[model samples]
Target: MAEERQRIRVEFAYDGGPYHGWAKQPGLPTVQAALEDALAMIIRQPIATVVAGRTDAGVHANQQVVHADIPADIWATVPRNAPLAPAPAMLRRLNGVLAKDHPGIIVHQIQEVPRVFDARFSAVRREYSYQIADGLARWNPLYRHIRWQHREELNVEHMNIGAQDLLGLHDFLSFCRPRPHSTTIRTLEELSFSRLPDGAIKARIIADAFCHNMVRALIAACVQVGAGQRPPAWLGERLAAAERTSETKLAPAHGLVLEKVSYPSCEQWAARAEQTRARRDS
Candidate 1:
């Protein structure tokens, strides 16, 4: 009989400062390239991985999700419950590969998942955050890479008011780079802004899916409102336009981070994927 295939899911985090985003590109470092290389070494064959989100260049992820398939022969030899107690030998081995070559990336957990689970299509929501170091926050070196340095003062209350207008289902074309062949409609579950204890502005957005540059674009629009350059009502006005707006600035990718991906119960994985794909494709 043919060797059975095992579908495995991995949760990991990476500092995007050195890599060129999550997807592999020619002549550039990428999270996917580094991961596939390590997997190839472990399985003794070429390997492919699917991610829940394709983060832009310079965008970090705290709990990025990925899924891969391997042959039973390869899976049988890898210990699933050894080498570090709960962390399987396979998981430790993969981390070893990451530490040696891709030190910025690390795998936290790995386990066999249902065959129907697809990291990208099966996801129900994605959470992202952006940091702006304005006011006195520019002096913090610890957040240099993850926080954008904005010189102008930002009103957190104003930003929050503008953010509330963006929460809900709408065609976010005004906040996304044009994707002519794809839909821009998305259900924004959450959009809020707060002043971090360190005086930095933290903006969080949650949505079913995002188009190119959407999160950063949304941040920029809200910043303009916070800076008193635009009225809080402008966001709703732009949403009604349903087209890309030249007035909105695109924020730097370095300040954005993919925080998490959520999904339904294992039994509903296939159904969720089906509905998500159908809507996304339409």
Candidate 2:
């Protein structure tokens, strides 16, 4: 009989500046490829991972999640002579490998999880933050990789007002790049803007799921209103249109970061995944 496999969940963070994206592609360095390569070295076999969110190139992640299945015997060999548990040993070894060749990625946690715990489908929500350094904010060259430097001064109040119109269930076609067989309908739980102490503007976006380019597109729309180029009401009109237009623009990918991915309790994992799958199928 084939050896039983154990499902493992890993929480990690990465600077996406050097990689193409999360998904592995031939002739391209990617977060997934780098991580899987590290895993394969330790396990002596190939491994694949399913991520919570497939962030685009130049988009960073403060905390990202993924799940992979490993053969039981291979997992048992992780801590050959060490006193550490398999999970902790695996984390240390993985980080050690990554540090040598892929220093931009770091593994925060690794644990054996229930078979039903899916990093992607079982997720309850994903939260993202976008940083903007407008004309009023002092330009910091050190943060160039993470902040969008805009020439125009932004009005935080106007951005907040425009963001309010995007809350709740809506077809965000105008704010999303269309993908084959994927729906643009998303329930935006929260969208807010605030000025940081450094005079830069920060946007916090929470949603059940976001389509291709959704977060950046939404930010671009709010930036327009905040810069006095459009009225706050224009956001609502864009949602109502349910179609992409020339006016739709995308904020720089470097300014965005995947902050977190929330999931239900252990007992609800399977149920949540089932529900999410059904909704997507419809």
Candidate 3:
């Protein structure tokens, strides 16, 4: 049975505010549990999911993808093998199961992908967004755990200048939590800010990979620059220094959202489709 097994890939999204993060915790609800529970109901067996990123609590995912190994026998029980139906119809059933138990969780799409297509390692880029509402309005209850409220006026120009320093490949020791097996090296592809219609400011960042708490720490540094407490040029120096200094502060987790994940063009789409078909038809 293991020899005939194939991997299943799924794209999902969630509001992370109420959970203890993406992974399962001993005493807290998590996105993983919700997904696994739904999968168990569908397949009539325990299911484990592997995510692209184990986002911290209060961090939302606009579109996150995960992969799991499902027996071909299980896949065959769905749409394609059903008297006569297209493969896409399977997604609807999966969503229905997920929606019943996981409120606020949405399964956007599901399809089988190559065994080599690891949700984490195969990802080419990850984009994140952070919202900051300046002044008293940032304290509004509606925005709790989603927006960072700053009661001080900010100098956007200075913040932009500081963020520019993080645009290239560099060792991000200062912004990351030190982990023994961690590599602080990463290439930042893009970073910029824009004002929202509601007078809140948002920081958009994209990178090949991020270190633990890297985005939060980067935002915290930017806030210091915006508030005139840190020189705008200091960010550039920190990126070059590759040193973790005591002054580095990780921003609050609530303000960050995992916006998207990118991958190489689907040259292997044909292979994936064929494998998917076999699993569904078997």
What TM-score does structure 3 among the candidates reach? Answer: 0.88
Instruction: Give the per-residue lDDT digits (tens) of candidate 2, residues 1-282.
Output: 867998999999999999998899999999999999999999999999999989999899999999999999889999989999999999999999999999999999999998999999999999999999999446788888999999899888988987888999999999999889888889999999998898888999999999999999999999999999999999999999999989899999999999999999999999999998888877
Best by TM-score: 2
TM-score of each: 0.94, 0.98, 0.88
Off by over 4 Å in 1: 1-3, 80-87, 136-138
How do the residues 1-282 of candidate 1 rate in per-residue lDDT, one tens digit apiece?
766888889999999999999999999999999999998998899989999989989999999999999897778777655544322776889999899989999899998888899999999999999999986635478878998888888988888887888899898988898667788899999989888887788888999989888998899999899888998988888888888757868888889999999999999999999998899779
Q: Is candidate 1 or candidate 3 better by lDDT?
A: 1
Tell me how far the alpha carbon of residue 123 in candidate 1 is from the true structure, in angstroms, after superposition. Answer: 1.0
Worst lDDT 10-window in candidate 1: 79-88
**By how many angstroms RMSD does model 2 differ from the true structure?**
1.0
- Residue 188 miss distance in model 2 (angstroms): 0.3
- Report lDDT per candidate: 0.88, 0.94, 0.81
Per-residue lDDT of 39-118 in model 3, one digit per residue for the tens?
Answer: 88777888788887788888899999898887777677766445533235557777888777677788887877767777
Which pairs clash (backbone N, Cα, C closer than 3 Å) in model 3?
Answer: none
Clashing pairs in 2: none
Task: Provide the clashing-pair count of each candidate structure.
Answer: 0, 0, 0
Which model is ahead, 1 or 2, in terms of lDDT? 2
Roughly what TM-score does model 1 have, to 2 decimal places? 0.94
